[model samples]
Structures are given as C-alpha cells and as structure tokens.
Target: MQTNSSAKKSKHILGLVIVDGVGYRNFLLSDFVNQSLNTFDEVVIFSGLPSESFEMQERANVSIVELPVFQESGKTWFWRKAKEVAHMQLHKYNFAGIDYNLQKNYPITKTKRALITKMIFRITSVFHSEKWINRFYRNQVSSFKKDEVTKVYSELLKREELDLLFFTHQRPPYLAPLDYAAKKLGIKTCSFLFSWDNLPSKGRMAAPFDSFLVWSDLMKKELHFFYPETKKQPVEVVGTPQFEPYVLDRYTSSKEDFYHKFELDPDLKTICYSCGDASTSKNDPFYIEVIAKLMEQNKLIEKVNFLVRTSPAEDGSRFKEVNKRFSFIKWNYPKWELTRKDHPEPWSQRVPLPEDLKDLRSFLKYCNLNINMCSTMSLDFMLFDKPVINPTFGTGENDLYDDQKYLRYSHYERVLESGAVAIVKNEEELVREINFSLKNPEARLKEQKELLELQIGKPLKGTSQRIAENLNEFSKA
Candidate 1:
C-alpha cells in the first residue's frame, strides 16, 4: 500500500512479463512481483494482459503499460525475410539447425519449395563455407533486428530512466526489441529461465541477456551446454516460483472439503489422469477411454475411482463424447474465460481467472495415484511425494501421435533418468502400473525422493525471496 508521497522517494524499475497463459501464472503468484513492490520505489509492468491474480492497479506504486508483441520493420524486416530464405536453403544441405516441427507440419507444396530453396543454399554453401556463412548470417540478422527494435521503441523507453529492465520470459518475440531498447538507453537487463525444456528443446532465444536467472543447477548446466557464449555472464540459480505455494499452508485445502467438492468416495482409491494439450497429445481422449473401460470391466483395483483434469489451454470439449460414454469418471476443467475469441496466435493475452494454486494443491493432496503422458505435473506430484504413471500408449491407426516421440525428447530425458515414474508402453503395462501404484503406493519411494531433490533442489522455501534479493542486489550494483 504505497502512498503518493512515499512513491516519490522510490526508484523506478521496469518489469516485463507475459500473462498470456496459465503456464506463466507462477510469475504473478510468486514473490517476483511482490518483492519488486518492496524493493523498488515505483514499478511499471509491461504485460500482454492484466492478471486477475495480481491486482497491480490497486497498488499506488505499481503501474501497467500495455506493450505490443514484436513485428519486424524498417531495415530489419528485409534482412529477416532474407534470412528465412537463406535458412530454408541451408536446411537442404542437412546443416541441422532447422526447426523440425515446422518442416514436418508444412504443407506438401511448401515443403517442396523449402527443399528446392535448401538445395540452392546447399550448392552455394559448398562453394562459400557453410559454417562461416551461417554464423555470419546469424550475427548480421541479429544485429539488424536489434537496431530496428531500438528504433521502433525508442520513444516509449525515453519516458523515464529505469534502474533495471527485467523480462520474465525469453521466447517471446517482444523481448529482443525491448532488450534492444534497454541497451540503447544503457539500462541493465535481466531475464528468467522461464521453462524446464526451454534450453534443451526450444529454439533460439529472442536475444542475449546480461543476467540469467534459472530454476536449478541442472538448468545452469543446460544454459552453458546450449548457449556456451552465456557462460561468461552471470547465471543465477533462483529456483522456480511455481512450487513456492506448495510450501505454504494457506493454499492447501482440508481433506474432507477437497473430497466433497469433487464428489469422491473417501473409501475408494482416487486416481488422477492429467491430459496434455490437444496438438501434442491428440490421443488423450483415447487414453481416458481406456481407463473408463478398465473401470467398467472391474479389471482395475476394486473401488478405484478415476478423475480427469484437462489441459488449461483446451476447453475440454474434445472429451465430451468420452465423458458421455463413461459417466462414472469425474472431471475438473480449467476455469479461464476468454474475452476475445480472436485475440491472435500464441494467445499470450488469454486471461486466466482461476483458483489454480488451491485446486492443484488439492488434486495432489487427495489423489492416491497420478497419471499423465510426460507432463510437468509429474514433478508436482513428486513434490507432494505422490507416485506418477506415464502411459506412452497412442490412439488411432498405427498408434501414431507426436506425444509418443515426446517421451524421447531431451526435456523429459532428465525426468526419465531420475526413474521416479512408471513409464508404461502399452495398454497392459498401463493397467499393471496403475494397479501396482494402487497396491504398492510407495514402490519408488527412494527414487521419488531422490528425483525431487535432484530436480527441485533442497530447502524449497524462500525461492521468491531469493529472486527478489538478487534483483535488489543487482539494482544497487
């Protein structure tokens, strides 16, 4: 509750965060913003959309600025378009830097065009050193993009002198231009290692950052491995703020109330099946059906009830047919309401009005066994010391789905290495794993404990505090 008079004495710090999706809610729920309020005299947040969870307008010291997502223009737009052509050409040479999903999903005509363009680049690369050309092209494109970014946002940035420029996520296109603006004004910049898979699996970052804050030592290692150039810069391990609420009692619900809300039989063993997004795990409905069939046949453990929690990005309408077939299974759909159905791609501006933390806490608390197809929820369940089952089975002809291949992705590699979960490959394995988890709930107790420690690190408390302190210390320097 900062006052006008008191706010006048505070230093101004600019903060950038994307409240576009539920995945980013941790930045709002955690101590990052709260600590900014305490440490800085005045704080300005440039966000895609306002968050209901964080009522910044009510605070006297905080202000919200609606910034546009990035678009290429001026000299940069020309170079950007050219680079796209060159990149397509380089791909034909099997240079190995292209985004595979993009190529895989492209229309047949587009793929052919890309292939022809790649052949052209391959021929040119042979005569003119492919590695050097690629490096030179990257550096040039990056430089022009930065220049154009500064040109576009210079006026907005000149409004005030900021003590620190902090961007919460690295993948957003808007960050590079914003970072360019910060550099033009000589403002110190910082960014968070936003996701678990960002380093290993995700494509190139928007831009190089002055300071990098990561979730764990594992993430620090990943930053070095992927972008060794950043090794010279400061890489701070602040842990992740998403799990901070779990350490607090205020967010947890009473066991009796939690059971009653979802209409569960307290005597029955409750199993949770968390679904992934539609694009990747299109067969989630099929998997849910399998569980329903097992339950109906009484093949599973006696009196074992199943609950399905759909992905936050989806409306859960895809499961309507399955739900009608299996009226016995319970569900908890995301409560987010979208204002504009056509807000734009990436839908980063989608507003999430949810009791998400409380609900997730309850889910992990009451569910005896949790199941999903390689979801981060496994980590959440592990934090609660609950067992998890990852069913790698697919639906449809030939059992094809991108999610089947996701099990082999680098992001899930560490979790798999930890061996805390039961990776079931087929229907029989899925049933066996579920029954085993129900019968021997503590089958992987030692493994689960070790996995939690390795992934999340110990002394889970004070993650937000540490982040705040680090920001404050940097501001002073």
Candidate 2:
C-alpha cells in the first residue's frame, strides 16, 4: 500500500480502533467521536463489531469500518502466552494481583499446550531481562504480521490517509497487526490504558504504540513502572471517558422518574449492589441472598430498598432463582446487545446500548449507597459522593480465586488505604457497614474526594474534550 501524504495537502484523518464493548462505551457511545471529528478533518472508527450492530447512520467525514475476526495462529498464540507468563513471573513479587494470577494459571495437570507454554516461559524466565521481554514482544508482533490482517490494515490506513491511529483498549491481542501496520506506514499510534487494574494485573500489552493515554498520573506512573520502555514515550494523563456520563446532564433523570422507571420506592433509601461478571464474582448470588435475608429478618437498623445491577458483560440469568426468591430486590438488567454470536470471545462482541448509559447514570446519581465485590463501580459511586461497601466474603474455602483475595490485589491497595469505602469480610460486618453507610452518607466524603482525585487525576467534567484536544495535537505532530 502507498502512503497518501503526497495526495493530501493538509487533511488530517484520525483512525480510532474499538476492540471491545467497553471501548464502544468509552469512545463511540461517549462524546469522543464528535469531539474528534471537531478537531480532525475526518474520523474513521475501525470497530471490532459489525457495522450493522452499531445501528448508527454514518455522518459526513466519518466512517465505521468493521474489522475481520482476528485468528491467532498456534505459534503466535504460544509466544503470546509465553510472554504473558514471563511477565507474570517477572512481576509476581511486585504486585500481589500478578502473583495471584500466576499461581492460579500456572500449569499443573492442564493440557499439553499449557505444559509446553509453561516450559517455554521457564526458559524465557532464565533470561528475564528487559531486553528479553522486548524480544519476546517483538517476536509476537512479527508473528502477527505473518497473517493477512497486516495487509488489510495497511490498505485501510493508506486508503484513509490516517495521520494518527488510536486504540481505545490496549490489551487485546487482535490489535497487534493494526499497530504493526501503523508503525510500518509511519503513522503516529497511541493506546489508552483500558482500566485501573489493567497495567498491574493484566499481562503484557498486545502491542507497543508511540504513546499512551492513561486515566491518572498514578496510572501514568504505573505504565512507566510496568513497561519501562514507555517511560521515554509520551504518557498523557487524561481522565477516562468511562465516568463522563455521571456528570452529563443528558444522561441524568429526575429522582422520581428514575424511581418510577425501576419500581423503586421514593420513600426508602436505595442501596445498589453492582455485580461483577460470573468469573470475577461467582459468589454474587450468595452475597445478594445474604443482603435479602438480612432485610427479610429485619436485622437492619432501618428499612431500605435493595437494587441489584448485574454486569453488562454477562447475562444475569444466573440470578433468576435469587430474583424469584427475593421479590423486593429491584433488578436492573443491563441492556447490552450481543452483536456477534459466533465470535470466539463472546464477551468482546457484546455492545452496550445508549439507553443503558442513561440507566447507569441514573442508578449512580439517585442511589444512596453502593455495594460490590471490589469493582470499578465503587469509583463510580464515589464520583457521585455516594457511600460504598465492598463485600469480600467467599465460600470460606480460603483457596485460590477466592473473592476475599481481591481486596489484597495491588490496585485495591489504594482503595483499602483510602478509608473511603467500607470493606466487609462477613455477614456481620456487611450488616454493620451497610447500616452505618446509610445513616452517615457523608462520613467518608473527604476521603472519597481524595481517592477520586488519586484515581481520576482530573476534573470529572470535559474529559472527552481533553482527550480530543490531545488526539488532535498528536495527529498534527
């Protein structure tokens, strides 16, 4: 593919890659697309989802291109897994989250492929230098280019005359070819660190971009700490677009309207129990039952309404029996749609609808208290100045993958130290914390603000505009 630099005089086109549902929510569903269009001559969204899934009418100077499903070859997969294992081994002692993941995933009586991966990782760990890590990353990158996807991206980048390529989520391995093509064509590339726990807990990044955009200065520091090579690259601390809707007027609804929509009682204080995915918090049903039973037995200090918001990444069918048992629990099932049923990673193909955004915003705004198993929703509630309680009770097995272990992860350390949230270990503490939080909603106000500042590193408003301004500046350079 030929470069379009000579054909175009001054037209600056930006290519934004959306790798997953969260990316769709953060970029396309937010004000980001409009903001980018305002700053650039044109914007092209290269989405991992099908174009039909968006249900959006294409506007002038903007196009949405659906990416072909990325098929990883066996060799590519092996190297990628090897790199991840080596990275986990390298940082296991530094971050407890990495250590936990390593201990859990390490091959014991697993498949032959797993055993070979472990063997290769052991050999790689013998060297374990930053140089070795970079080599492993480069090998993975090279292996990805062996496929036809690189050519596809090369053609797309050249055809669009894209001056800058930005990845909404940095961790998906499918992004490697696109990143490679951008680099080969000399287009500037930048990747957003997806979540708070991504850098420390998630394995090696799929590809190395020219720069990185992070949620906070703390995250920027984390990026440099985990990938020291990124230290020399530009790391912009623009607060994430994920929480922008919390402050947006259009996403908000009146208290009465919100209560009526969910059949919530306006007279009672609402305690929202936000559930993580099935894999992350399998004990969510048990937690919900405990809360329901507390309300059933009238053990609480005051009668408050219970609201359960299931994870958008999953269907909440698992809570059917619990919902049936607890009639009073107002359930807000997420409105995310499954776009590609045949996709290998079904979770990635799930796309969030715009209505869900409004529903989520309302839930955060009007809910008096929030409860979860150490989720980012805690930060969302904190942004609203609402009290939060993290229930960390497992099945008392004390084995690996216990829900209780999440509190000790590296990312949650700041949360624990902040004293902004109540961490309950058992039903007794859970009852006490929930009642106390409802009674004194402003008890942790100061700490919550401090923690938000530490996590977000920017004012809540205009985060999308900030990101756009940065992207425009990067495109021009």
Candidate 3:
C-alpha cells in the first residue's frame, strides 16, 4: 500500500467520491481509476450504504465510506406530513378524489382509499406547511444532510486537505457539504453524468459542475436548448466509457454458451431487454401480460428468444419474487442463471446481480438483439452496431417534470431518426417492430451504419482510453 510518486509532485490531493455505489459504478470507476494509475494519494468513495464489493476494495488505492442513510425522524404528526408529501410527489395523483376540481388535468376518478389519502394530505399540507414549517420535518430535515456533509468534509480536510474533489453527482445534500468544505479550503470540485437528480432544490447538472463530460453531441445540443442562457459552461463530448468496452471486435465468450446455459434456442433471433427497474414486480401492464402473452402465443417466434434480464434496480426482487411463478430454474442473473421456476431465488425474496463489469458485459454480449426503455445500456448496443428496439413508454406527467421530451430525444430521436434504431410506441407496436427488425435485419444494418455516424462522432476503438487521455491532460496541470 505505497502511494505513487506522482502524489508527491502536488500538495493537492485529488478526492474522488461517488454517489450511487452498487453495480456498474465499480466498472465505471475502474475505467477512470485504471487510467489514473494511482496518481492520487488516496481515493475515498462515499456510498449511501456499503455492499460486499465495498468491503473488498483494499487494492484499488482507495477507501470506501458510507454516508448516513436519511430517513424521517419519528412517527410524529409532522413526520407523517413529510411522508405524505413524499408519497404524493412519488405517486402521480393524490390518493384522495381531489381531481373532482382539477379534473381538466387529473381527468381520472379515485378509489375510496385514494380519496382518504388525499384528504389526509390536504389536512397535513394546510396544518404543517402553511401555518408552520417544523410540522413538515422529515429525514432530510432531521438528518441535516448538508450540515453532516460539511462536518465530513471538514474532518477530511483536517486529516489531509484536498486539492481537488470530483463529485460523481451533484445534489446539495450530497454536494453542499463538500462544496462548502471545498470552497472553505479553496478546492476545485466537479461532477460526472449521474443524470437528473431531483434533490438539492437548486436546479440541475447545467449548474453544479465546473465542467461536464457529456456522452454525445445530442446531449450537448439539448443542454444548449434547455438552459440556453448558461450555454458557455465548460463541457466535453468525451463519449461514455461504459460503451468503450462494448466496441471490441472479439468478445471474451461465445454467444452460443449463453444460449445453451439458458435452454434458449440458438437458431432463434433473440430480442431481450435488461429490464431497467421493475419496482411493482408484476406492474408494467405491458410486460406482465402483453409481452408474456405474445411470446407464449407466437408459435412463429417460439424459436426466437424474447427475454428480459431483470436486475436489482427499481425493486431488487422483481425477477426473482414474481417471475418464479413461471416454470424456471434457480440461480442469479449475475451468474448468468436462466430459469423459469416456481421458487424464490436463493437470496430470500430478492433477485441478485453480479457487482462486476466483466460479468455485465458478458451478460449484454450474450444477446443478439437488445431492447430497453431509458437505460444507458442502450448506448452500448448503439456503439457496437447491435440491432435496437426502443420503447417510448410516454410516462405522462413524470415525463413533463424532467423535460423528458427534450432530454430523451438526445439519444432516442437521433437513433430513431437515423433509422438505426426502431421506436415502438406501444406493446402491439413493439411486437410488430421487434419482429420486423429481426426479419429484415439487413435494412437495420444499413440504418445502424448511419446511426454509427450520428452517435459515434469519432471512430473510437477504446472509449475508456480516450477518457483517460483527457484526464491525463487535466492531471498534468
């Protein structure tokens, strides 16, 4: 555990910390860390909670630290009010039947339970937020995340003042303490593409980082389109390292091995979605019924693999808990375990995934055709010129808040417009499009070439290496 000589050259210690610390993050960090080559005297990782992978990082020239998990203080009336706010914020409409007045927009009726929840929320908001603020106290307010963060950074400075701190995502609760701490010590701070954070109340990525490294020109255009004023903020279209590994000529494992393990037919044209986040388990009205029904009924495509790799995102137990009802076997997604069993995955009410990058790439490579909603994994499919089928679910109001219309188009529009990717508006369309893409893949191949031109501006063989090159220039200073 010796520090690299490079660390001695500068008094400033580069402090790099991440926000979401579960899966592909380690691999993403590896692409950057490997490039650093132990350039920093130390690397500190900030996680909401520590996982097994966090404990095994002794050799990476870094230390993993967990931040306090924020939760509402107690079951006080005020706390309940905060919970109501969170619930309403998460759910589209009020539980109550308040839409009677706002029907132009709400348009729908509510259940008796919904009506009750709405009334409770109405009473809470009037009592807590309008008259007094303390009644709205929640985990965020109780934990004083900003203050706690300030204390953490203050102590880190006391131990060894940082010269530069790079934040993976910027939210006041997460970044405020570090921002204030770094500001106090005159440290430069920046953030990476953690995506639109709904916290901090100060606004979005266009503001936090001193500089940003965007994945594509499409993203850059959207940035300029949305916040047209702050157009001069420094940023780079450095591409994503997540895709760098996907651009290889030869994969480590044979695709046949993936099919045989799953009892999937090799002669069949496979189309699968890495199931971004299945929280409600059997929720998505389309997947549980439409997809399963189509796959089961379609004798023509029975030889074709129509699968969805459900990981542990929205609700970790999605694929494992409910999916076990279908005839399948045991094992995990990370282990490449394919089954249609009626029992639980070994994790006890949870589906498990591998916490490594190699395993993930292997998983992605196993499929001939890929489908997804909004996961960054789609970028990998685009990078390797794989056939893609994208579904624009049109998530109603939630889509409006994030300005999803403008943002998603950065990737979605370009791919769809170039005809490199197919956009299916609904489940029926998805069925038609998925089959069409497979049946006439050569046409897709031509579209894929055009898409390669739009998305991949530079003919990059190693995206990670290019990122490392950029960072090298920054570190040289």
For all candidates in order, the CA lDDT equals 0.69, 0.86, 0.48
Compared with the true structure, what per-residue lDDT tens digits does model 2 show for residues 72-140? 888788777777777887888888888888777777777888788678767866856667777887888
TM per model? 0.85, 0.96, 0.66
Candidate 1 — which pairs collide? 10-41, 20-348, 89-118
- Residues 241-285, candidate 1: write the lDDT tens digits: 778878776677888987888888888889999998887778789
lDDT of 3 by residue, 1-477 (tens): 546444443443556555443213433334555554435555555544333445545554566665543332233323434443432332224222122112222213597645554665565444533223323433323444345555675666445555556665544244444555665666655554544212211122212345555556655664454334327665566655444544443334567766775677677666666655543122332343355566667733345665556554433354554465544322224432222123222221222233334445655666667766545566666555567766665545533112123223334445556766676666678788767766665557777776665555445555555554544444444
lDDT of 3 at 72: 28
TM-score of 3: 0.66
Which prediction has the highest TM-score against the true structure? 2
Off by over 4 Å in 1: 1-14, 50-57, 73-107, 111-152, 395-397
In Å, residue 235's CA in model 3 sits off its true spot by 2.1
Ten-residue segment with the worst summed lDDT in candidate 2?
1-10
Which RMSD does model 2 reach against the true structure? 2.3
